[model samples]
Every structure is written in structure tokens, then in C-alpha cells.
Target: MGENRIQQNEMSRRSFIVGAAAGTAGLAAAGLFSGCSAQPNTSTDNAEKTNSPTIPEEFTDGVYLTKAISMHGPINVKTVIADGAISEVTVLNNRESYVIGEAAINSMPQRILDSQCIDVDCVTGATLTSMAIQNAVSEAITLAGGDPGNFKGYQSPEPKEADVERECDVAIMGAGMAGLMAAWKLAENGKSVMVFEKMPYVGGCMPITSTAWNAQDTIIQKAWGTEQIFEAWSSVEAQLQSYREGRIEPDNPYYNPDMPFITPMFDAARDATDMMINIGVGFCPISDWPAPQLAPGAFSIGGKFCLDIVKNYLTYQLGVEIITEAPVTELVTNEGAVTGLVAKGADGTVYHIASKAVMLASGGYISNNELMEQYQPDELKFPLMGPPWATGDGLLLGQEAGAALETMDQGVTSHYSGAVSHAEISYIHYVCPGVVVNGSGARFVSENMEYKQALRVFKDQPTTDFYWVFDEVSRQGMVPSGNSYRLDYTFLLETGDATEAGNYQELAEKLNLPDLTATLDAVNECARNGAVDEFGNEKLRAMLLDGNMYAIKVTPTPYIAQGGLKVDPACHVQKEDGTPIAGLYAAGDVVGSVENRDGAMYRIGLTQAIAYGLIAGETMSAEL
Candidate 1:
């Protein structure tokens, strides 16, 4: 952790501008890093795009440049084969996710070099990058006219176990937005903190960010007017109504009349913002936050990079120790009160960490398919976003320690994706508000409905498979730019995720949507006339063109889990009887809102975790 603290922070994706002409990866193509001539990455589809190129029967000793698609895009590796053996491997180009994929990028080359083996065990939690490197190596071998099978079966070194025993005033699980903020506060309050993260990286699920949070009286809000706070509360008033009517969870906000549940969250969000700003972090007012934004207000921490400011402060200035790839397995309690925890390091070593108190900030259950099937069955069909480690570790740990659950039935969905399966390169239709048709070939909801509302409409349909019908002119560009949200036609076309036809009717036939021809014609008519049609969508002005049309398969994916460990206002893990478990606490997506257990939901950026995390830290600091 000490050795990697600087490296991982330096390579965080939010502000991943590692300068130098010596830069590898995509920088070489742009001549920004390796000073090579810029070779534009094209979108030419190859019919025989197998996992690896054809393996040659004969040996040819030479450096082979080969590319394999990674989590985000292609990974180009420069392979040196000397005397029919792989001598060296260097990553040439890739926009692979940082933080999560940083370890695989930094270590795989050396590991391959050490063993002359292309099939190494993937770095845990970075399977996509690891797989890409292995495939790229295989392709390189094939290009060098060498049989890729010769490079198989890497014999890794024997595992060794070293159990570590450590003590801290407060031990936090998961070094994400919540855990980090809690650690920062605890350290500031003069507590020694130890943070254990399961992933090789520190950033949580939305490593890029969790979208903008609406704070009431932050400096940005001061500049943008704080009246939006009233609007935000008013927006949730309906949810409050559902709670009162016993339609949702039984968490009545009016239970404590003296302490109306909304204000503390707003104040905490504002203070959390100020906390970051005080540490040299900045903010930007997001006028165009995605739909269903906190009414009248939205903002983020100067983009995703601002989080590193707090991460660095906790690990360096505050001396909080963060052990990455150490998954906390169980809570070590004594006499019915929480005491500490037991964990396992990535190396198979045991970590018995003793602390005065524990905070479970180990993120959500989105990556856990079983939990999804149990809690949110309808969302089970959708693809999951974020790393595979978001399996509700905190929730499991809390349950083992006798904690109750809450909001197990609610969760939010991501943008309606046409082609997010390939390295998260999105389809332009989601943004363009293009012609969307369900499996039945009929337009369902308005294309421009609020993000989640539209997702529900599509997700509830008989089939999860949907399509985005667009013309050749609508085929957008590449995923070369680090922003994954931007459309990448090259990826879609090459992967055949987007199929083309001479016209709309042909495209419909190819996609097997029987009624798409009529749907497409009606949509075209509405767009050409700029008329609000059946769905009342005024934004459908971009009519579908006739020549060489494309239809990309589309569907909504699971964004994050809703249900988690139940906790009270003070961030304490609560029992079914509403009694707080001493020395036990939780924050982040591991628990929904601390104000109530009304629902598992889509909370805006940072504030959800930061608010409860700070409260947990301060409360623990005071109680202990």
C-alpha cells in the first residue's frame, strides 16, 4: 500500500494527464507521448476478429505490434520475440480504465516477461485489462509466426502467507468516497485509521464519479442561489407521501417531529462540500445534469478528479493507512459489541485488524448477481456497471454481525444503452434521442423521458432487448477520447453490435422487428414535420435518413444496488427493534439514507456517502 499509494493516485482516471513524450498507450498515436507519427485509430470491421489472430505454425523472430480490445477500447502491445521466445512486452496504446486497471497495466508486462507466459492469472478486480494483455500477447505471437500455444501455461510462484496484525482507533471498510471521507474526519479528530479496500484501486463504483450532488449552502450554491434546497425537498415530497401512505418502506419521516429528517442531510451535504473546498478542492455548477436531478440545483466536485485531493490528504497528510486488495471478511466482535474485523490480503495472507470501532463503507451490491436476483429481480437482466467487487461486502459483514437490512427493493438504472457492452462505448441514440424501438418494433416511451423513467419503460417491456435505429450520417466517432460516454461508431460497427442495411425496412428485417418499418416511417414523419407525436416528444427533430441505415441493439443496464445494511441517523447499524449496535456503523451505498430506511435509490454524487461518512466519523470520535 505504501509503495502503491502514490502510483495509483497519480494514475487516477478523473485527471489522467500523465505528461511526457515518453508516454505509452494512445499517447504514442497522437505523438503526445512516444513522439511517433499519429496513426488514427480506424473503425474498419474485420470478419475474422477472433480472440487472437491466427497462430502461425513457423517461428519468426521480430517485434510484433498487436491490439486486443480491453474494458474501454483496444490495448496495443509491442511484443519483442527473440529466437522464437517472447523477450519483451510493452503496452503501446490503450485507454483502459485507470485506478481499477492501473495494476494490470503496470504489472502484467513484467509478469509476462518474467515467465515468458501470456496466460497469467488476472489481477483481481482488473479482469478486463488482464484479459486484454493476455490476448494481445497471443496476437503478437501469431503475428511473429509463432504458435501461441507455446506461450501458454504460466507457472506462477508458490503462494506464501503472512498474517498481519494491526491496531487503529477506527477501522473503515472500503476506501471509496464514503470510507475515505470518514477516515479523513477520524484522522482529523486524532484517531489512527486503517482502511481496507477489496479492489486493487481506491475509487468506488462510479470511479469516474457519481454525478452531481445538490448542496444547499455551499459556495457554489451561494453563487447559484440556495433557494433550490426548498425545491429539492419539494421534489422528494412525493416519496414522503408514499412513506406516509405505507406504500413504500415503513420509515415515516414524521416519527421524530422535533428533528424533521431533511435538513441534516442538506447541511451535511453543504458541509461535505465545504470540507473538500477547505482542502483545495473546487466545484462547478452543472446546469445540464442528467434528468431527475435534484430539483432546481446540481453540482459535482470540479469533476471526478477532485476526489483525489481528499484521498491524497487522508493517505499522506493525515497518515491514514489504506491497504488495497485487502477484503474485510468478517467483523470481530466481543460480548455482543463490535470490536474489529478479519480480512484477507490479495496475496492470500490473513489480516486480523483490531480497532476501537468499525465503519462499513464497502459500497453497494450491484456487482452481486445473486443479491440482485433476490432484491431487484427485474433488474437482474441488465448488465452491471462498475467493478466486480461491489458485491455488498459491507452488507454481508454487517449481517454476520447481527445487523438488520433496509430498502432491499429499490435501485436505479443507467442510461438507455445501445452498445455499452464493448468497453462501455455508448450508442449515440441515447444522446441524440434517436428512433428507439422495443423488441416488438414499436416505439414505447418518449425517447427523452427522464433517464430513469425511460429506463423503467424499456426494462418492464416483455423483452430487455431493444434497438436504436439511425442512418449512416448518425454513426458517430471513436472511443479514443477517454470519455466513455461519447458515442463510438468504430467499435459498434467493427464488433457488429451495430448492423447496417440499405434502408429502414431492410434494417428492420435484419433485426427481426416485424413492425419496425411502420414505426420508423411514423417517426420519420414526426421528425420531418417537427411535431410532438404520440409520445409528446418535442425533441425528435432529427429524422431518420433512408440510405444505408444502422440499427444498434439497445437496453438499460443496472447502475447500482438499492438495498443494504440498515442504519439510523447517527450512522449506527440498527436492529429490527431500532436499537443501535454499539461500536458498529455504516455509510455509503452499503446503507441507504441514514435519515430513513425508506428506499434504496439513486443518490446524487458524493453527498450520500460524504454526509453519512462524516457523521459516522464525528459520532464515533465523540462516543469513543
Candidate 2:
């Protein structure tokens, strides 16, 4: 139940597992014990009498391994017991997202050891990983001949308060990708920087990000043989067209025609990519979807890799300070210029850090229901896919310091067909060659329309209820391709959100679409004759005429708010009069209008965060 005991147990468990597996047959022949079984023996009854097994005091001592399935994949844990006491727990393997899983992986094992039980509290914002870890530990305890239900963990002593004040050149709220990158840039230039993150872990939403950065002509794109496809002028024109056609909100109050931020940001993105590469970030070719013309020169990498590089370089190489589990509650402003902020540590200790400048990269308010209702009432009804920590803390802090917000009515709403979960949707795969219908069972729009257009169409549906109808062939094609991170078909089917029928009539009946039969017949006739549907989608018209059909319930989930505190090109929070708020800068989802580039044509958010973070860092370093 101590740190030393846990460490010893971990080492013992590894050795025991290796030895046991090596001599499995010999041990069985000698009748020393039964074959290795990961399942726990729950025959013992206790006061709680829960389904979980109760650890008996006279149980044997040994090492045990068990596997538990999590949201992403299986997690394997090894538990060691010594003299009938739970000694240690070790996570052998896990495939959970780094953003949500890393903290749990690092802390849960220790907590289990300290408590001498498997019922420790889970890491917040990481429910799946926490549950999986706890489950694996429970099995391991049972296998180690201990009753998990009866074992009482140690009671942790209350934390003592410490003087945690610090003075720095810059104080950043949030240790996300943007904040970390900015801290690195500033600290590298000989400035003292402190970054505070509310979460016990860093990375924010970066781990869930697409990890695709956009630029004009870049070295990677040139090497990939797709440089000629990305023309700067044409890309801008396409964005303008999207705005002009009202595909994006044309009534954006933050739209500044004279100061087109996209042009400058795109130009700097090339340098950002180069910087990333110099720092050892790797990339794969971007997926050629929505036409390569519209897709900027983009490449994919795991956001965790980028975050790890920035965190290590800033903390070890540049000496930037990062404190996690410290939430900044208020901005301490003096005169007309912003000065510093106050943050609270996990143990309720306050730290008032003074600084010459502050950057609000604490992400958007997608998860804040109050702010969502205040800014975007319509979108508040939908499920949110953004990080849980994006509770508008930065916006509130910036606004309290007299910064102006813009385009508050807009957000990034994605249309995907399935039950809501943490898994990333396969938009490109699901949107191809399918028939979308409303609650009334009537086809609403062309399935092959641009993603934004499809979202708009789905948003306008009655009750916002829709489904994607596809045949077996289409479903087979929907399987994630090589190295694609989208959810696989098997997983989707297992969620029970997708339904299948032998024929169109059965499918329609199952979906309660009274007119689905006739609709399918008409669609089939068009596909048979190679004709375009009413929505002018020839690609969709060529499919939906064959084999077993299916319908996936579709919903538009809010990913990130496209509007936040308005900022200038230098990433300075600006007032309505177009004047910058002195000493206060914003980046990432906290500063909006960047996502509305070319009228919200749907560019990569991660790229904008990195590019603008670098800009903010450089600007603050020079100006402050």
C-alpha cells in the first residue's frame, strides 16, 4: 500500500508472469496451481455483497494479468500481491486516445496501489479509460487470489497549502497544443513563461484532432506530387464563393474585408510546417477528399506526437513552466492593459501569477451549455463532440478584460450517421454514394454534396432526424481504407445505431418511413437508367439499387464553435472599434473568425491553431 511496495510488486509481477508463462505446462503437471485464468473468482460473499469479488485475507500471493475492452481497444493490466496484500498494478497495454488516456495510465495504477483496492476514482474527462483500467485491475486482483470488493484502500491525507506565486514575462491559460507551442516559442527567445492547464493532463483536444495542417505550396506537398493542385488565389476564390453562395454564414459580423486574415495565416503556415518538421514531427499524405483543389496542402500526423515534441522542447530544452490541474479563474487586469491571472491548484491552493502579457488559448465553449445557449441557442440542442474542458473560460476571462466577441452565432457542426460517442466519425466514407432521408422517409438533398452543404441540409431536416441509406456494396466500400483512422464497419454495426433489412420495404418499415418503399423504387429506377436525381447528384443516382440495404441514423454534432473573442492578425484580442486589447492575445478555439475563413469553407482547425499560436508567440515576445 506504499510507493515502495507498488514498485516492488510491479517488478515482481513482470518476473512472475514471464516465469509462469515459461513454466505453464510444468506447473500444471506438478499440480501446483490451475492454469492461468484472467477471470476473477467471485465465490466469496461480503457485507457489501456486490457482484465484484471480495478479497479474502488468507488468499495466496501471486501475479495476475487481465484484459478489459475500452472505447478504443483492449487494455491489459498486471496486478501483484504479496503476503495477502495488494502490492501493485501495472498497465501493460492500452490503445485509448493519448489526450484522455495518458493521465489515467500514469495515475490510476498508483491510486490503486495506494488504496489497496480496485475501486479508486477515475480520472475526470477520461471515463472510458478509467473504467477500462479499473475493470482490468479488478480482474487482476481476483486472479491474484484477493477479493476486490472487501479490500479497503488507504485514505489519502489532506494536502497542505504552499506559497505558489510566480512572476513571469508571459502567463498562458491552458497547456493545449497552442498554449504549449506559444510557451516554447517565448521561452526559446529568453522569456519566462508559465502555462496552467485545468486538466490533470495536457494535450487538450489535440489528441482528438484530425492532425492535418493546411498550407499553400509546402515542401511535403511538393514531395507528394500535389503542389500544383493547391493554388493560393484559387483557394481564396473558392472560399469567397462559399461565402457568397451562403454555404457559410454571410452575416458574420466579424467579417473584415480589408483585413483578410486567411491570406497571411496561410502564408505563415508553410513556415510552421517547416518548424514542426525541424522539431522532429512526422507526417503522412493528406487524404484527397472533397476534391484536392479545395483541400489545402495538408499532411497528417498523430497530434500526440506533435504535442509530445512541443511539451518536451519547451519544458526540457527551453525551460518553460507548465502546471497541470491548475485552473485559471480570473484575469487580473490593471489600468487599461491586461496584467496577469489567478489560478487554483487541485488542493484548493490559489496562485496569483503576475505577468507582462497573457495568452488565452484555453479552447472554445462547446461543452459549456450556458455559453452555448447564450451565444448559439440552436446549436445548444445538439450533442457536443468537443473536449469537456472547453467551457468558455478564456472567452469569459478575455471579455471581463474588455475584449469584444464576434460571430457568436456560428459553430462547427458535423453530420455523421450513428450513436454519439468519443469515436471519430468516418465522414468521407459515410457521405459517399448514399441516399439521405428525413424523418418523413422522403429524400431531402443530394448525398454527394459538399460536406458543408450536407450539414446545412441535415440541419434543416424536420426534427433534425435523418438517415443515410446505402446498399451492401456501399457499406463494404465504407470500410476504413489503409491507415485511415475512421471507425470500422464492424464497430458501427455493433453500436446498434445502424439497421439492416433484406429489402427496401423491410428497411422502410423498420425506420418507420411510410413512403420509403416508393422513394427507393424511384431512386432505383434512376440508378438503373444512369440518370441524375432531383438534387442533381449523379454519383448517388448510380448507387442504392442493389443487394441488402441499410439505414444509419444521422445527427449533426457540434464539434467546435467557429466564433469567439475577435482578434487581429497578430492574434491580439480586439475590441469592437478594431483596437487591440493591450497585453492580451488569443489563439486556438478561444479566438474565433479564423474558422470562418472564406466564409467557413471548412479548413483544418489544428493548422489554424499552430499557425496562429506561432504568430501570437512571436508578436507577444517582441511587443512585450
Candidate 3:
């Protein structure tokens, strides 16, 4: 109920700016925005331009423009302007959505240019392009004898109110499940908690997310009947205990209070649905509930559950109010102690929400072009998939408040095809159902690895381009499962770039395999054997085959940056010098995850969020 009120009041902040900037991009040559150059003479002196490397005669013929473009990486570095001279620039080359980028470019004026460098920000996913255009404008100023750093057009908006007035026991930055869960527990303990969200809506990335889980019983015994489920769970529990004592330590990333300690997680494959159900979430219970277990130690869960509904239910239960469209502009501190946030509504009105403590759940920079380039430069080859509002707002806010960022090397990303299936929607899982073939048209990966491992397998492939081939039967038979849905053969042939073939031989021919006969024989043999059985074939085969055949050219699309604000086990945002920032806390996606762990998102991971957010809230409330 509070989500609606916040959305109404904060209407302007909801639209994400990410991915709205550019159309798609190709592998080679990127696109640049063409507009009136910022009156360069206002900022840089012509003398300064010549003092450096003189523009060659060849470079002088045209204006040099720079544009940041999006590849698979959240941000990519590409120069539309070559040799610091304007190469005739065109907006059409970028393959991302053109409307967002074109609109920003068209609005680029001397007045706007005067305001800030790349301050307008690009749409999410197309961050590179946005930065490129911003740089291009700045470069133009440098060329025209204006200081690139001196900009004057748009006056930055000021905060609506000072931060010293408001007060709360706990302040949460997001209204997502984790945040709500934390608030619920804290409020029950009598904490005055408030939530701040940049979007009008409160749910962070969950409304559209598909929810699936792995449980202790589901994997150990492939039984769907609820009756036998507990026994299977007990068995898993026993095995996990053994593993914990033998291999996993209490502090180990995978250690879960719910499961027995085990070295190999595969031994305890149980149904994740049981746990989610216990937590007040629902899932489809058909045999799919106890979805097939991946290889030993490989676990998975998949179900379609809209997050919007989840958010509504959670808000009602938590009794915590949310403020949406209120992008936090600053962190207020006194005497080197954290206090609260300086935020602005979409209407440009700002306010200070004082709090005993603050949790930065504002998400990451997968949508920030400038930050993306500063981090994963190599990922520039793929298009981005992130919420536009995910523009490092919380990260910057935390940093300004004396919080130090960490894990620049890690990001919350998984793999997808080169082309984005849907940029605006969050639930679209781009798993292609066809047989994966390497550059040599050879199948290299096990068909039923866990989604993370499956994605990594493809990522670790020698060639960037692979093909996903499936047939009509395969499509219809395949169901949308997991947080990200996989394509069944039918879906592949009907939509997307899947290659259509009449028969296995024809499909093999289309895929450019070395020999159609050999490929077909191998596939048939595997199918007959019920899918790579040596690796647990039936469950793998059930998810792999659907028929009549189609294929999609696949490449690695990295989403989610794994690293951000460094927080201790207690969820306290820390400084680079290793001191906790007073009155500041972090949770959910904005916080750094357990280090060096591949299975960070499983049960133990969410437990960490819940535990830390609880600690922060409790500590803040106690102080109050």
C-alpha cells in the first residue's frame, strides 16, 4: 500500500535511465552522437590545444568525436573521434534502441553542455554510448580552445533540504524482499525504519524475477510427492553434515545452518521449493517442483513468480513505509559520523531523512557507462542488461559518506546470448534450448550443469560464438523455469535467431558442423542413452531435447557487477582504511558478497543479507 503512495509522489524517479540511451551495437566500429558542439571557446583556450600534440592536417579536416558504446560489458571504451579529430559521426551504427540515445544527443545543447560532463547520464546498458557522447562533447570543447573540465550550461540541482532534521532508528535504501524482511524484523523490535528507493516502485529487481530454489530433499530423491520429501531432506541433511565436518568449515561460504556440512554440495541435492514455501513464497509443485537434479553437487530450481505481488504482500506484512522516486543525492554526516541522506524527489524537491542508521541497497553500476569502462573494459563486447536507475547512486552516496568500495574485480553477472532478448523486462531468461556447438561445431559442455556452471562453461569456451540448435518438439516440451527462463525448442524456432531446419542432417548442415552424419549420430546416441548418462542423463535429457530444430548464435553477455561497497559480516559499510562508517550500513545487491566463493547466491548468501541487515537495524535501533 505504501508503494503506491511513494510512486505517486515520486513519479519522476521511476523511469530507469539505463539501456534507454542507445540502439544495439555491432562487434566492430561503434556509433557516435552528432549534435551542435558545445561552444568550446567558453572553456578551453585555443593556445592550450596547439601546445599539446598538434592536430595533424588529416585530423583537421573534420571534427573529432568520442562516444562510449555498450558491448557485452556494462561499459566499453571506443572512440568515434579518431586522432582527437572529428571523424564524420553517425548515430545509426549503434544497434541498441536508438530512441534513448538519439533523444539525449538531440537535447545536447550549449546550455546543457554548460551544465556537466556526462552528467545527464545514459540509459542503462547503453552506458558506454552515453559516456562516449559526453566525452565527444568535452573533446569538442578542448578543440575549440575551451577547458574540457570547465562546463557551465546546466546548473546542478541543489538538495531540497538539509540533512540534520529528520530522524529514524533504521533507514533502508531499497524496498525489496531483503530490505523489507530486515525492516519487518527491526520494526517488530520497535525500530522506526524508513525505506528510500530511486524508482517509484519499491521492489528491487524482484517483481519480474522468476523464483526457484534448491532444497535438501529435492535433489537427493527425485520424488515429487510431498509425503516423501522430508525423508529425502533428512538424508540430504545427514550427507551435508558429513561434508561440513570433512570439507566445509563454519565460516565456509557454503555453510548453511539448515543443511548438514558436506564437502561436495551435490550429495545433498534436495528441493529448494520446500524452503521458499516455508518463507511464505509459492512455486509450481508439479514434478517440476522437485526439478531434476543437475550432476552430483549440482542443484537448481525454477518457477515463474511475479515479484510485484511479492512486494505488495511483503510491504503489508512489514508495516514499513517506502519513499520512491526519491533518489538519494548525498550522505549527511557530522564530526565524521554518518547521519542520514540528502535526497530529491522526481519533482526536484529534496528532503533530508535523518536516521540512526542507513542501509544502501541501491544496486550497482552495470548501467553506468563511465564506471563500467573504469572497471570491466573487456566486457565491452556485449550489450548490457541492467536497470537504468542502477547508476551507482548508492555506491557514490556511500563513498561520499566515507564508505570504501571493494571487489572491483567481482560483479553480479551471469551469461546470456550476444543479443538481448528484452532490455526493459527483468524475467526474460535467455537460455537457448538447442544443442550447444563450439566453433568447431563440437559439443563440449555437459547439458545439465547448474545454471551458473552452465553459463561459466560457455563463458570459458575457446570461441565467443556458439550455436544453440533445437527443434519444434523441444520448444513446446520445455517450460520456463528458474529465475531466468530457458528456451525450449519450440520457443527458439518461433522467436529469436534460431536456425530453422527440416531434419537433423539439415540442421547440422545449417550449423556448419564438420559432418552432418557424425553430428546426427552423436546427438541420437546421446538422446538414446537419455542424455550424457555418465553425468546423470534422464534429468539432463528432459531439459535438453524438444525437436524439429532451430539454432541461435550465442556469445557471452555479462550482467551484474559482483563487487561494490565493502561491508563486514555485520553489514557495516567499511572504509578502504578498514574502519566502519558510523551510522551507515549496506545490504542486498549493493554490498560486497562473500569473497572467492562460486556458490554465493545459494541459501547461505541470502542468509547473510538477512543476518547483516538485521544486525544493522538492531544496532541502529538500540542506539536510538
Candidate 4:
């Protein structure tokens, strides 16, 4: 970890990079966006790339080093030039998110070498990393006494044609939370399981994850010396009543008026803790909180890392088969039941995988703009917060396999989608005792309220910008319980995304908010008295009198476009007539979950991935 480690080596799950982080961080640390100023050589020199271009004789056979831009920072690369041809391009160091970064770094060099062109498409869902690699190579070319722009437009070598055929007891689409979950259970039950992910990486939207979510009497809980805690599904009855009143189609069969719970969701919610633990996704309980929700370690081992643990356990220990960068293009059906799928691999190999059961967990359609504009307005689309690979392939596959769609427009579960920076800095700082004031510098909603409700409250206001204002004491009190998933507030200050002032008047002038001084006094008055304020908020009980008062701007961005294929309690992809599609199952974001109004985080969204994944895997295991 101290040096630039190769990607093929065993990776450490711990947070912080040491070795490569030291390499080009000086240049990168100068400014957040200044590091990526080196532009691509777009001279269009031989745009057709037919004739082979000769290497400049000035270039000697030697190694060259250069730096390029990555998602978070800079990537140092070593380029090998031998025998008058650019040979190997090795990424010396970077600190990108593991999955997507791996795909681009591991493959792009060989891809360029094969094609022999500086002009090539970056890996899907990995634009920044891909550019970083190519740009590093371009710099190396310049350093080798040659025009870097000359590397483009060479006739590309043709890929060897190949095809692969396989048979498995279960074939799972997507290597995300739900698919990997299903693979774990199926493999454990001695079933031959194969998981295919279209993206070059394993984790789908999970790489952008935060919570460990809703576990009751699991091992982690036991170690915390806490008894089993039941998560109150307060919104279930309301959702059920709404469904009963109008939401359900006449043919929909999942609803039973006498049933106390939304059966599949409830059953899955209860098992989530044990299921995650069993899958080897590790975490700890929220401090002093009695709820079963876990706070997964952020920035390092939080969302995608948790899934990576599950993926590693599934593939290495449980013997689950996962093929990345291979997209299942179509479903092969026989007499109205899906029997298999056809996929194309990254190496131009066709994969015909035949299976007894197919589980569709390819995730939501947030990344697909055409599908997104259908359900949401351009202004409200929190598209960037979504994992770039969630292109709704599974939904399309389900539709092809005769599944009904519902709630496609309602999937933006959180009112504020995700991240101030869509790239590596999406994680917001901890939701602490703070005041989010509008442009006029007045607290609009209760600081402790959920984002879904917060956005609703703010919509009536006339301002576009919102600032999270808090004192030094309040920030320090909350830092120990920080989630790196939120953008670092300190980093925000360094990057000028936030402003800090020693006092209220200074802070007000810096942000051009004239009313901030009055706002703080009223808040301090309420805090000193230890009573509810006008907004009925007790969360603002912290006085803003500490050193270095801070204000970080926050925006409600686009995230997961929720609502998708409707499924029964059994995890079956339901048809319009409320009938099950034989040999087909769906889980995760592709299927809608039990509705909730508390602005629940992982409760409804992630629960579907866990619960339905478990149910579908178990059901398929029992059948086969």
C-alpha cells in the first residue's frame, strides 16, 4: 500500500492510500480541477486509422513516466517503448473506486496496444479513469521525442472471433447486490451459478453505496450486546391501503386484504441482517441507536466494498461464477418460459448460457437518459448520482420476457438524489446537528428531517442554493461518527465549495446572505432555552458560538430513478395479468419495493435487493 500496487495483487480493504498516493498528489493536491488540464491530442491525424504510422526515430528504446487525471486525483503511469513501437502502458498508481477503476486500468492498455491507437473508447461507466490512462500514455509519447498526436488513426488489428457455450443450474444477470446475493445462496445450495455483469466491474450501483441497512439479531448485533430490534414498517399499512384503494391492478395477486404485511418485503426485511452477515458483508451498529440499521465504514469499506466482500466470498469461497464486461443481449425463450440468454463478451466472444432459472437484477434505469426523460423532467433528474452502469437492461429483458411494469416514475426515493460532485466526491458529510439555510439565510425545514421531506419543504421556497451552516463545536461533536460517503466538509472548504467565517457577520458577507446574522441569534436563543423552535425542531439545540463557523453549499442532485418491474412476494417478474413468468425472477432496483414515506434510506431500496434476492434464490434452489 505504500507503493503503487498493481491491480492484480490482493487489495487491502482498509481506507487510505499511502504509496501511490504520495506520487503525484503534490500536483493533484494543488487544486481539485486543475490536475486534469492536460487535454487529449485531437489532431485528427489519420482519423480513418488505416495505414500504420511509423514511430519517430528520435524515440529511443526506454521507459517513460507521465501523469494524467483520474476521477479523484492524478494517476502516474509508466510507459515502455521498445523496437520503435509503443509497447506496454502500465498505470503506476491511482486511488479510484475499486471496481470501475479496475475495469478501465486493467484492460484499456491492452486494448490500445491491440488497436494501436490513442483514439479508443474509454471503458463503459469508467470515462474518467479511461481518459486518465490514455492521457498518461499521450504524455509518455510526447516525452519519447515524438508527437503524441501521431498515435491516433492507425489501422486497428482485428479481434479473434470466438464463442463460449456453458450450462449452469442458475444464471444470474448483474453482479450487483441482488444478483450476487442470489448467487451466494444458489452456490451454497450446491447449484451451478453463473453471474454476468455488463459493466467491466462487478458492483453496479452498489459502488455508490452507504448503509449496511436493517439487520436485527445478526452476529454484529450480538457483539454489540443488543437484543433483536424490530424495524417498524410504519408506512406499510399506508402503502397497502393505497394499493388496495387504487394502485393494484385487478389481476394483481400479491395483495391480500387480511395480510398484515407486504409479505415478501416484510419477510426479506426480517432476514436482511442475517443474510448480509452470511454473505460476508461486514459492518457495525449505529452508536447508541437501538434500530437494526448498520453504519458501514465509508470511503473505504462502505457500499461497493461491502458488495465486493460478498462478490469475493461468492466467487472465491462459494465457487460462484462471475463474468464481467459481458452483456446478455437477449433472452432465449421456449414456449413462453425463458430457458437461456445470449451475451457478448468484452473480447468479442459470444456467450450462450443455458440455465434452468434466470434471475434479473440488472438494477435501475437512472443512467439511461431516454428512459429517464420519459418519467421525469430534465430539471429534476438526479441522473448523475446513479451508478453509471444502471442502464435498465434487465427491465428491457423482463419486458421482453413478458413482465409488467409499475412505479417506473416513482423510483427517485430520496428527494435529494446524491452527491455535490458526481464523480469520486459524492459522499456527503454526516447529517449532524446543523442548519441548512436558503439563499436568504433562514432555516426552512427541520435539520433532522429526511431529504425526501426536506426537498418538498424547500420546493415552496424561492431559492436555488442551500447552505449547511454549523459551528465548530457542532461539527467536532459529529466528526467521529462521520461517513466519508458524504463529501468531506474540510475538502469542500479547501476546494472553495464551502465558506468558513470566524463569526456570523463575516460568514454572511462571504456568502452574500444578509439575513444569516439574525438567523443564528434566533437559533442560539432556542438552543440556550433547550426548547422547540418555530419549525418544531429540537435538532437545532446546538448553539453556533464555537470557533470557525462553517457553511457548505448542498444541492439536491439526480440519483436512482426508482420504480420498475413489478414482482410478487415470491420474487417472480409479474405479467400484466398478475401472472408469473415461468423460469424468470427479478430483484433489486429492477423491481419495485414496499412503499414508505419516512424518507427511508436503505429500508425500501436496498431491502428489495436483499429480501427478493434471498427469496428468488431459495425458490429457484428448491425448484431445481
Q: Which candidate is the best by TM-score?
A: 1
lDDT of 4 by residue, 1-624 (tens): 211221111122011122222223212111211222244445555432322122335865557666654555556777776776778877888656655676788888888887767678778987767777777777566555567667887564466658888999988888877887788778889999999888877766555444544434445655665433333322333334544565444443344444322444545655656666666666654454433443355443366557667777888988998998788898889999999888888788888989998989898876666676676543342224456667789998899899988765443644342123223333332444568788889877777665633444555577767787777765653333453334333434433445778877888889998888889888888888888988788756655554678777766654566568877666777899999888898888877554421122223466557766777888889987
Model 4: residues with Cα > 4 Å off, grouped in runs: 1-95, 101-121, 132-158, 227-263, 266-281, 289-296, 299-309, 316-319, 378-383, 409-411, 414-432, 452-463, 474-488, 542-547, 596-604
lDDT of 2 by residue, 471-525 (tens): 7767765554522344344444544457888877789888899878788788878
Report the poorest 10 consecutive residues by lDDT, candidate 4.
6-15
Clashes in each model (backbone N, CA, C under 3 Å)? 3, 3, 91, 14
In model 1, which residue pairs have backbone atoms overlapping below 3 Å?
21-33, 25-92, 25-93
Ranking by TM-score: 1, 2, 4, 3
Candidate with maximal lDDT: 2
Cα lDDT of model 3 by residue, 37-109, tens digit: 3344543566344233332333222333333323311222222334433333343333232223333334433
Q: How much is 580 displaced in model 1, in angstroms?
A: 0.7
TM per candidate:
0.80, 0.78, 0.59, 0.74
Can you give the lDDT of residue 430 in candidate 1? Answer: 47
* Overall lDDT per candidate, in order of appearance: 0.66, 0.67, 0.49, 0.64
Ranking by lDDT: 2, 1, 4, 3
Q: After superposition, how far is residue 160 of candidate 4 from its true place, in Å?
A: 3.5
RMSD of each: 8.3, 9.1, 14.8, 10.3
